[model samples]
Target: MRTDWLGAEFDGVKLRLWVDGALSQRIVAGSPEQVLQTMLADLPVTDRPLLRSGWPDAALTPVPSAVAVAADQGRMPGLSQAAPADLMRHQPGRIRGFLTTRPDFDGVLCLIGHSTVWAHLSAGEVVSFRSFISAELFSMIRSFDALPAPADPADDGFAQALNHAMSRPAGLAADLAGLRAQVTLGQSDKAQAASRLAGLLIGAELAAARPYWLGQEVVVIGDGQWDAHYLAALASQGLSAAQADGVEMARAGLQDLWQMMQAKG
Candidate 1:
């Protein structure tokens, strides 16, 4: 039987199709509803859709055979009606599990999305987690009349600010204030200020996540740009990390769960 999975992240939604134990196709859409609509449009009468809510707000309207991904320690109010009893709030754990399923895997795992950071130990335990107001900040910053556009990934301003934030996590608030001051006085461009603000926020997360990252091997999973920022930040601490595509990991996780269900049946 052909099985399709639809999942949502902070940035967008993704659909993965698996047929007879092989992945056959993948699609990306702007929103969960749009992705689901697309899936339904072409869905065969014999097929059912599986949904995994990555963020807090990713639940589709109830449909027959629609299953949700869940975590053991958390509740996804969005997926409450669609998820199976055996599947629970173990997303962070599942991501870690998928990473470890690879050969010779051992280390700390970091999942950095648009507005959240999840750090997990090699033992499949969550060490630290946080959800920031990144979208809110971006919206607020965009509303400014004179601020420069967001910084490019190649900007030294981003690296420098990220290093500074990691080193002085306690000064985050002060650093943010300084960013505004610099921008207001024309001492720094909008791009530089924006980079510094991001640095400050991520730096704080790195600080809190020190226990998981201090001496462990780390791997990052998420959007390429955000992953790069996190990799650079970790490198600033003299730490090295491997990178994995978040979409692939999400698909792998859903596949793993689906196989589990099939086995039980």
Candidate 2:
């Protein structure tokens, strides 16, 4: 039964498809609409399968607008009602991922991706939340020639920098400038520089988001070195977070949505 449905994910630059337990991916060189149309044309199916869009505002083109799936339409037992229109427009997939995986969690969910979200949940409903673009900033900084790569999360420099940034987020600019000076003076290596940079950014983010997870049972979901950094940083502050696979959470979210639609029908 699972093989009867095709799962497609487009993140602006790439398109990934899963069918019959097989995976296929390609660079989205042309308009997403064209790419999706082409892919659909080649599929060996007769009837049109159910279509699900992560959100109306996704980078993927040709999706139904927000008005199409009104808040009341996607309600479930625990995750009844979609997120606010603005938040839904930005992080629908991540919110869906969290809802599907930890709907009844009574604490906070820290979803790490290009943009990280810290959402407080109680009785399977979102109470309050905040979003951070720290990861995006980290990526942008790492693109510079001075810091061409990120350091391993285990590096001592990373921990020290994280501590420093969390303790005094206001000093971030000076600290960053100091790193540049150290690098220019040949006082720091690339690995140490990168680690410190990442630590500083993440630490500042954690500092700003302290109220969200200060005394809550936290679960972190993501799949990347940045995610590992988040876990390690949280551990540094005496907080332990359970981890879940982001990919699995997303698939589960979509599955839940499908079941909800079937039930409605």
Candidate 3:
């Protein structure tokens, strides 16, 4: 079927996904109707129904028909409105499990399906980043977008790290453990360790996206804490970085970071 976004403007972080809608639907088509309804039990309520979010009252756009078609992952045309007591926890395309912000921002964010502008923040800067293009991530529970989710925020920060770590090699895990230990000990080399960790994690996720990055054949390193500490760690090491080119950013590990950030579930 032809597809559309139901055009709505959400001004925040920007992330991207190339949904193979046909593939997704082919997979979902075989599931029983009750199972599909059960999985998407808590679809979020918004001013916009077509648009679902994990953030509170945030505007949302529904997953394009193409995605529903391709992923075959939702109730699609047969979805029913959720009752107040439904235990189901989200719409298929709804993003984020939590939506939060410091005291100053006007709108709250949802933190489910994908990464958003909020992620690029340094607990300080509110810059717009196109990568993982999202308006924000919220911890709002009881459904924010189409997905009905726990109002309690999900620990996405940790989820992204741990999820990626699980797929990588034991060697890389060992390396990260050692590095983190040194970091906890207040080692002077934490800056360098973090820098290297960043690259390794980036490498691992990117490699995973390749058709050949079989789970048994590859090793990944790093969790995203390094990025959280990036600027401070760089200063600690006395390194002045320059503007990151998109290609280099992807090559330098943003690509893998992208993969991890885009992870499902």
Best candidate, TM-score-wise? Answer: 2
Q: Flag clash pairs in model 2.
A: none
The local distance difference test score of each candidate is: 0.55, 0.66, 0.26
TM-score of each: 0.68, 0.80, 0.25
Overlapping backbone residue pairs in candidate 1 total 7
In candidate 1, residue 102 scores what lDDT? 63
Q: In candidate 3, what are the lDDT values of residues 1-265, reduced to their tens digit?
A: 3222111111112221112111111122232333324333453322321222111232222222111211111111111123211111122122111111122322212111223111122222222211221112212210232222211112233234334543563455575566557656867253344344443343343333223222212111112322333222222224332221221221222222223334642
- Candidates ranked, most accurate by lDDT first: 2, 1, 3
Q: Give per-residue CA lDDT, model 1, range 1-265, as digits (tens).
A: 4445433222332344433444433346465446645655664534554434344354422312122234222212222222222211324423633554663455666765535444443334333334444534644654663555456645788777767877888887788778888888989877677776667676777777787778888788775657777787788889988888765675666565555555655
Better of 1 and 2 by lDDT: 2
User: Model 2 Cα displacement at 99 (Å)?
Assistant: 4.0
Cα lDDT tens digits, model 2, 56-92, are 3344211122211222333211222334322433234
What's the alpha carbon RMSD for model 2?
5.3
Model 1 alpha-carbon drift over 4 Å, by segment:
1-39, 55-97, 103-105, 124-139, 142-154
Selected candidate, larger lDDT, 2 vs 3: 2
